[model samples]
Target: MENKELLKRIYLLVKPHRRRLVIAVVGMVMVAGLTAGQAYMVKPLMDRIFFDQEQALLNILPWAIVLIFLVKGLFYYLYRYMLESAGQRVIRELRKSIFQHIHTQPTSFFHKTTTGELISRIISDVTLIHVAISRALIGLLKDLVQIIALLGVVFYLDWQMALIVFILLPVAFTPIVNFAKKFRKYSVSNQQTVALISNNVHETIAGQRVVKAFGMERYEAKRFSDLSDRLYHIIARDIRLNSLQHPLMEFLGGLAIAAIIWYGGHQVLSGQSTPGTFFAFLAALMMVYEPVKNIGGMNITIQQGLAAAIRVFNLLDTKPEIKDQPGAIILPPFRKAIKFRDVSFSYNQANPTLRNINLTVVAGEVLAIVGPSGGGKTTLVNLIPRFFEVSAGKILLDDHDISEVTQTSLRDQIAIVEQQTILFNDTVKNNIAYGDLDRSEDEIVTVAKAAHAYDFIQELPEGFDTEIGEGGARLSGGQRQRISIARALLKNAPILILDEATSSLDTESEQEVQKALANLMKNRTTLVIAHRLSTIQNADRILVIQEGRIVEEGTHANLLADGNVYRELYNMQFKNSNSEPSNLTP
Candidate 1:
């Protein structure tokens, strides 16, 4: 977010429409030329009225004034319309690039950021930058033309009056520059504070269920209020600073005009300057002052736009923590096995979540990972598709390093059914077909039946076309899980991950889901993360994990016989269930 970097990004934004911008600039110059004619016309008209025969020129005078206005109005519309259109197109393209870049960012970015703040950048800040660029560019061009043309008129009428303009320029500019510098700092602070406030509100509303369950509503409200107050204070401060320049410059402009009139009157009465000539010089001075004032205001707008540009550029400049390697090849279909060689990972580098560990699964085997909460079970499965980069070691897919292959190909070969149901607001068939975009109706139905979702789907009002609410809120937890399973089934990837997929279901629902999962795992390489020991009791091999590393690994029966960690865990769940009375006591 350095100054040079900001300018570079702004340049890139305008580069695509350079030809259009040039045309717009030419239009703006024509507009300025027509506008400058008004100042030039005042001198000739004033001289003809006073010195020449007034009646002879009277009829033509009104016509000339009318023509000047006509030309000015035409050029004004052309310049404003063309330049504004160019700015809108450039901003549209910039916003699209930002959205696409965000999509390409690693999944971890979402975990660390809020959607609301990102949305504000894409919408509000972008619009501000667009307005600033378009208006500032056109205004600067017009001002430059006006300054040149008006200064020529002033010097022609009286060189002494032109000196007053030179003196007034710096007096008007110094305060504006100082105000703009302060406004820039405040504007950036205001944006950051507002982003924080927006994030607080979004997170609170999204997690309202937990807030209510824990009776932490007051705490969340207070947190939101504090951030909101900070935003308010910063914005008010920026407004106060921005408001100062306009009035102070207006006062200064008035003082300069007063000084010019005082000095020019003495010259006119002394016969050193004609009354007509003095009026002509004063008209040019008035014309020049408007651009100077506008330039002063435009400086602040430019600074505000630059502040927003810095934030946008910061996002664009960020490097993803996970990305494909240069010259990486796509992974071919799995035929042999998958291996993790001394893998370790962490959300934060200071604390390790997964330790150095080695595990292998044959092409068509089900390897279950059993662990306590936060034992890295979900984290381990996430690594299979490069959702995160391994911190210490490499993971290989059929002897090729996963990092050496493109993410799209690696992910396309794997499917995941998460514990929480994540369905979009779409028809039942669309949700199931989400895993495979090109899947036909038959393929979708076949996969749904295999995942035990077909019966419930048919019973719904619209059957396969029934609209599910956001996140499948219309469906029961078990039904949502089945839909997720159906999605994985339709994918038909060589590798599958079931992360506590059925752990949240009731006993009867779990039994049915386990059957569906078992059938789906028949000929595919599956990685299971189980919280309920019973769900994975029939896995090909079980790895008992504690903290970050594997503590034990064996078959279910063999581990039970060993009477170690797995045996202890199995007995605990079993004893808890058996401890319940068979009949209720009176």
Candidate 2:
């Protein structure tokens, strides 16, 4: 994005709080005026009170100086408060907008990005922009106004001295601008390293069980240490560049002060200028450098903020690959069947995962899909919910192309229960009600009872209100799967997809969850991906897929009679189960 365009976008974020910004700017103006007034008072104090022995002016002048500072302090606090308040509001809105945009992105986008990286951008990068708005931009404007006001005082006292100071001022900006560029380059590097460290920490903590089991603690520690060390070096370089600005500004400021003291003092002693006038000029000149130095520092901050903004805007600019077409109609509830007409899909164009597939699933029929790992079973089902777009061909629901309907309406008619149960760190009630948030307490209990989850749930101390730990770590695998079933059961959609829902459980748990799955799948058009062939023996039909192609399709008895791939799979599973001692009833 262009600089102007970036600035305009930032301005829009602040535009909502423009009234508060205006009030803050008014306070800044008052502060600048008071700062100039303090310098202006120096002349009367020196010449009238000290030199001329004006005793009456003495009592009033001291009080006036105190009063001026008291008012300036008040306005200073007000403006800082106002700007910071506005800055916080802007940060809140920006973070929300970025988060909402992230949700709009396709699943493919997440495959290419890490959760840690996105979290870092939302937290760290947005903070940089916050500082830029609340500190850098406000400081730049306030300092500029103060410098201008102080310069007026200097020129009024003596234009010749003011002209000399102005001439050398532009030279000081050269090093400041160059240093700012270097600071920004280092800042970007620092943020990237921080993001890597975040990713490492997130992965380490999330997979800590694996780390402990594999005894890779030392290796993970060393990896994190290396990333932390890299970050330290980048930050040190940024600090070196940042520290250089202050002393460099002081050197240039010292030179300007030295010139003013020499030439202005000479004029005073030679009777060409009054002592009071020369002192006032010196005071104003000294005050002017403070704001100038601040402005120089703000330039570096602005650069850092701009770099961060570029990253944030780049993410926001990404258009989601899957969105409803313009004028798309809302799909009504499923009635007849789902048809995939010559469907093909590929994550990358070089390789296809599903190829020229034509399949129809009639309403209320349980269609079992049996396949080897990586045979596109999951990919085929995911396309129904528009999790990914098909590379070629189209899917239709009762003759209406699914792409011609709103995704929300299409997904509303379907519910999914996957192998890995996903439950948030919330109450059991909330997790179950997620399927249909409008469900009442009684309705939630009904579904829980239907999924066989109510027995253990009531055994908990808090019953429905118990807080489940992250991903339901507090619950056993069987309990979690039952809760997942309860969630799906509550949706009561016309279509259901069960992807190896009982694969990870033991015999006892599988038997328990299989009952819950039966309750959830009742009267729904169900698609089952069976990990164990025994679970789907009663399915209306079973399709065997291998290497992205349907190799066989028939009833379990028919497939067994044919002695094809399905029969071989059935025999292998049957032999394996028979060889092992089993507690589960046949």
Candidate 3:
């Protein structure tokens, strides 16, 4: 993305508001013409009032000058208001577009990108762009108009003096172009550093409990200081460049004025130019320099905005890897089995996560998958909903290839409850009835009661209407898990994928959740990513996967009798406690 293309895209975005922009440009032109008119009056004031001693002209000239300023102020307000209004609307749409783009991305996108960086891009980077649109716009457009109008005044008074001024003026601004490249470089570093700071803050806050437990407050503080110091260095470089432009413009403007004074004084003495004309040229030239200074000051802001726009545009260009195929059809209800034929998957394609995996989970059967931490258990479950496309093979849901179905229809039939339960900062009822917002209160209560969550719901201050705070922070671990289970129960999907992460709970809480799990798994085809033996003890069939391959498959007792991978896992789990692995809590 070159800057030209970026600017073109931004122009397209601004096109919808062209009516307001045209009016604003009209107002700006009026203000520019009036600016030159102010310098024009200096000529009459010098020649008529003082030199000719015209008493009658004084009254009209003062009132005319006052009228010019009053009208200029009106146009100034009009243009400022219109430009900002247009800018705000464009930003609103741009921010929303960015958010929607991020949501449409595949799950793997989230795996590779952090929440903090995305937050920084949406908030910090967009704000930089906002400043450029709202502030730099006025500087660039209005200043250019002012420069042209003022140049007309100087040229009208004496083209030779105006030519000399224009020649020196370009020299003053040449350094501005030289420094622009550095401005963008520093700004990009600054935005990235801000993202690092955002990431560090998000981590510290999300893991505050761990930070306290490990007593790493000072360590985290040091890390944050490092990020802040990095931002400071980058910002300092940008500001230094900005400051350098200021003095260079002042020096050049001073040289131009000095040359004008010497030449104009000689012209007036030689009767080639009048004092009034020379003075008016001096005034117009000075006003021209003011807009030049404003432009120079905002140059860094504009360049920084362009840098931020590059990042924003790049993010927008990343189309989602997972989306509906052109001829995809809505999936029918799940009635038979989900079969994986020669299904091999890898996150990066370099190393296989699931290799030549062939399996069938029949409808209404409880299939327990037990494996080492990184043995692809979760990845296997994720493939069913098409969170990631299979690297090589296809998944068939009820004899229909899942890839051939619309993702929304395919996902509608599946309900998932994982180790880290996800709940929004909404009400208890809303969380449970997330997909079915139109569900009645009675229906919500029915699912809540089934998951053993209705009792806790009544205990809260607002009952079913209680705000759970972020990620159910206000609730106990068991309470949150039960609410999560209630949500899945409400979905009433035929297929259920449960992580069975009850190992983190107390004995009593685990029992409560286990009861909820029983209700949730009653008639659904369930896949349990089992970590403990208690979860899979009653499973119809247990699978043992190791290093992306199925090592064994049988009931719990049959696997133990085989005395292979399953038996070794049983020994390792129980060896930590007494002989009773089932009684040993997670």
Candidate 4:
């Protein structure tokens, strides 16, 4: 996007606080006027007091100087405070908007993006924007005001010399523009590099056990150091570029001062101007130098801010790929079955994950889906929730099409217990009662008992209120699984999807969680993606999906007797144990 357009968007954000901004601008004008008035005082101070030997002027001069500076300082504080408060509020609102927008994205967006990158954009990039809005933009306005007010003073004192100083102002703009371009390019790279570092840190921390098991601490550290090293070089270039601007500006300011002194001295010596007039013009001209230098510094910040703004707005502009269709009605409860008619799905345009799938899961029947890896078992079930819209065809709940109904109403009737148990860094009770926040404490305990999680809950330090560490790190795999099952139980959803819930458990834990799973699946229409042939032998029917197509469907005994793909898979798990284990990878 063009910087001009980006700036307009920022204006819209600031528009809400225009009243405060106006007050700040008024404060800035006061400071600018006071600065000009201070320079103007040099005339009378020089002429009436010293040159004309007016000793009586001393009585009023000290008080006048103090009052001018006192008011200038007060206005400075007021404007800075107002601008900073406004800037912080902007940052707060932007962060909230970005956070809310991110959650609105489809699940597929998260699959392609890293968690750390999102965090970096939220924290680091927005902070750069804060710097630009509060410091740089505010400084630019104040400096511009100072320049204009000081120019007016110099012109009133002597127009010919005022014109001379004004002519050199544009000379600094070329380098400032060049530096701004370079700063923007580097700033974008800088934000990306910070995201990389954030991603690396997140991965290492989340997978610390894997790193330790592989003895990869030094390797991970080396990787982090490499990213930091890259950031170092980028920032060094930034510092080098930033450092060059002030010196170039200072040199230009020196040239302006030299011209002013030589020209104003000639005027005074030729009696075309008084010492008072020449000195007052020189003072105003000198004051212009500081604002010019400040403008140079503000350029770098605005550029960096612009770069951050690009990433932030880009995220905000992304629309969720999956959202309720206009005029879609709330889905009624699942009754007869979930029907997939000519359903197909592809993660990308080049490859189909599930092809021409036709299946019906009855409202109260347990359907077991078994297949070799990459056979689309989980993907098929996920389609029911509209996590990813089907590439072609439709899914229906009884007579109602799932696509035509609102997702909230559709998902309200379903519960899932995935292979990897997901828990939060919160109390055990809160985790169980997550979806249904209105559940009474007694109800949470009842579900806990039903999922066979009560025993462990009672044993925790704080009983039901015990804090489970990040992702339930403090709990055993079986304990976490049971807690997850308890959560599903509390939801009391009528449709259940179990994606190999016991896949990672040991024999004892598996036995415990299977009891919990049995309690969770009671009377609900269940779809089970199996990793073990033993677990789903009692399913109403077994489906063998291979290479995105259902190759076989029958009772366990019938499929085993037929000695086809289902039999082969059964033998692989029970008889031909040397074959690779079953899992849902697609």
Candidate 5:
């Protein structure tokens, strides 16, 4: 990310909260003015009471001192609160925008990214930006004010002394800048390692069950330790570099101060300068060095923040590959057919997954697709829902090109039950109702019955109210698949897809579920991607796909009579079914 573009983005986030930001800036200015006023008051008090020995001024000095402190303290508290509150509000909005963007990103986007990295960016990088704005900016402005105010006082008291002080400024500042530059490099390194450590911890915790099951707890721990050690060493190096700042500044400032005091004392004795003027100049010189040191430290923090900002901007700048086209329209209801014409697709263009596939499924027809594992059956079905775009050719619904319709409209008419059940870690009723979240309980029960899920659900301790474990691990594979079918049934879409939906079930469960499926498939354009040929032999048409093209298409009876690929698949399954007598786990 270019620095100019990055700053522009960051500035936009602040724009919504501009009123608060302006108030914060006003508060900072007020605080700096009060602090500088208090510093300026010191010299006046010393000159009147000690050097001049003015009796009346001496009598008023104590009260004046107390009043200055009182005013400074009040402004300090008020402005600090205002700046902090404004900064926090900006941070809140920034985090919300980032999270909302991530939520809307498509499934394919997540397939190529890691959850660990995304989470770290939202949690850690945004926080660094927040601190930079809230604390560092305020500190930087105050330091600038302090330097300007103190320099003005010193120059007013004695121009020659001020000039001398200015000449030494570069000498005192050079090493501090050089040292901070090194620490800035180390700071960026440390931050990256810390992010790496966070990613590792998130990954390990998410997969802890697998680690424990394989008895690899020690191995996981050692991996974490190794990553953490790198973070620790990087942090140690950064700290060492930061440590050089304080003493180096102090040494240089000290030598300059010692020289100033010696020269001033000689001038006072020789009658070239008065004790009052010399004392005031000396006091102002003492106050100048602190602000200079703070400014140096603030620069280091800003550099670290810039590094974090680059990562954040990179994420924000990324364009999602799949987005709605201009003037996209909602897909009308499916009254005729879903057609794929000369369709070919690949996640990467170099290696095609689906090639020149031409097919159509008319309204209320069952189309079963059978193929070897890598022959693109699943990929072809995925294109119907626009889970991915066809790299070449087009898919049409009712002869309307799907790409012309909005993604949500295209998906609203279709439903899918995959090989694995995808139930949320929620109550059984909610999982089924998730298909149409606004559906009434009565409606939920109707669909569950239609999927043969009501019987097993009622047998559970809490019936529909029972909390199913993550991925529905609390239930058997057959039961989970039934719940998934219940979800699809509840969707009541015009098109239904079953991708090996019954492959994991027992013979008895399959028989019961098949009855429910028969009912669900009635009057809908249905597609089944099946591994078991027996389940699909009854389909209205079986499409035997091989190497991304349909090699055979016919009814079960005709395909069997033809003695082709479908017949061979049917015979193999028939022989196995007759030979293997089943008395297995239910």
Candidate 6:
């Protein structure tokens, strides 16, 4: 986007606080007027008190200086405080908007985007804009006003000297413009490098176990250090560009001052101007340089802010791929079977994940899907929740299309326990209660007991209140999986989806978890994606999928009798199990 459009959008954010902004603008005007008033007093103070020996003016000149400064300081504080407060409010809203927008995105959006990149945009980028709004933008307005006020005084005292300074001023800005372009380029590179560093830190910390097991500490450290070094170089180049502005501006300012001094002194000696007028013009001329220099500094901040704004706006403008259709009705409770008629899905459209599949999952029935690694078993179940809309055809729940119903209501009827257990860094009680926030403590404990998680949870330091570290790092794999089962049990949904829930557990843990799963799946319409054939032998029906197509379907005994795809899978797993010595206790 163009800078003008970007600034306009930022200005709209400030519109809600227009009253405070108006007050700040008024305070800036007062500060400018007072600054000019101070320089204007230099003439009467020098000519009347020191040169003319006017005792009347001397009596109150010092008092006048104090009063002028006191008022200027008061308004300076008022405006800065107001602007900063308004800036903070804007940042708060922007953070919330970005966070809420991220939640609206489909699963595909997250699959393509990294966590650290989103974090940098929401936190780091917004902070730079805060500096621009609260300090740079506000400072620009104040300095511009002060420059104009000071210039007016200089012209009134001596027009010839004022014109000389004005002509030299443009020379300083030429270098500032060039530096600003370079500052923007470096600033953008710096933000991107910071995001890469953040992504590295996130990955290393989350996978510290893998890193240590493989003895890659030195390797990871070198990788992180390389990213850090790149960031340092980018910032150093930016600093060099920013530092160049001051000295060059100072040189041009010095030249203007020298010219004024030579020409004005000659006028005084020639009796064309008094010492009072010459010195007052010189004072205002020097004051003008301060605001001009401030404006030059603000240019760097503005450019950096603009770069940050581009990223933030891009995220905000992103449209979510999956959203509720207009006039969509809330889904009622499940009373009939779910039907997938001619359903097909593809992530990239180049390779279809599921092809022309048809199936019916009756209420209160357990239908297990056995498939090879990439046969789209998980993808088929994900479609039920509308995580990714089907590329073609439709899914119907009791004759009503799933997509026609609201997402929240549809998800409310389903519960899931996956291969990799997901738990937050929160108390055990809260994790279980996440499925149903309004679930009573008694209900939570009952479900935990049913899932066989109550024993280990009670052994924790704080029982149910114990804090589980990130992703339940403090808990054993079996313990975490049971907690996940407990969460699903608490939801008490009519539909359940289990994606290899017991596949990752040891013999002892699997038996315990299987008992919990039996209780949880009592009357629900359950869909099972099994990696181990033995676990799903008791399922009411089994479908053997291969290459995104159902190659066989029947009971375990019937499929074995048929001696087809299901029988092959059963024989393969049965042989593998027999090869390994049994760990089961008699």
Weakest 10 consecutive residues of candidate 4 by summed lDDT: 577-586
Global lDDT of model 6:
0.88
Question: Candidate 6's error at 169, in angstroms?
Answer: 0.9
lDDT of 5 at 201: 82
Give the TM-score (vs. native) of candidate 4.
0.94
Cα TM-score per model:
0.92, 0.96, 0.94, 0.94, 0.89, 0.96
User: On residues 491-537, what C-alpha lDDT tens digit does candidate 6 reach at each position?
Assistant: 88999999887776777667666766776677889998887776787
User: Which 10 consecutive residues of model 3 have the lowest summed lDDT?
Assistant: 577-586
Question: Per-residue lDDT of 237-271 in model 1, one digit per residue for the tens?
Answer: 87776677778888887887898899999998999
* Winner of 1 and 6 under TM-score: 6
Off by over 4 Å in 1: 54-56, 455-470, 578-586
RMSD of each: 3.8, 2.1, 2.7, 3.4, 3.5, 2.3
lDDT of candidate 2 over 30-85, digit per residue (tens): 99999999999999988898899899999899899999999999999989899999
List the global CA lDDT of all models: 0.83, 0.88, 0.86, 0.86, 0.79, 0.88
Tens digits of per-residue lDDT, candidate 3, 47-158, equal 8888898999998998998899999999999988998898888888889999999999999999988888899888877877877876896658889999999999999989
Would you list the clashing residue pairs of candidate 2?
none
How would you order the candidates by lDDT, starting with the best?
Answer: 6, 2, 4, 3, 1, 5
lDDT tens digits by residue: candidate 5, 392-458: 9999999889889898898899989986678898999999988567899898999888778898899
True lDDT of residue 366, candidate 4:
83
- Error (Å) of candidate 2 at residue 303 is 0.7
lDDT of 4 by residue, 122-144 (tens): 99888889889878887788889
Q: Per-residue lDDT for 471 in model 5?
A: 76
**How many clashing residue pairs are found in candidate 1?**
0
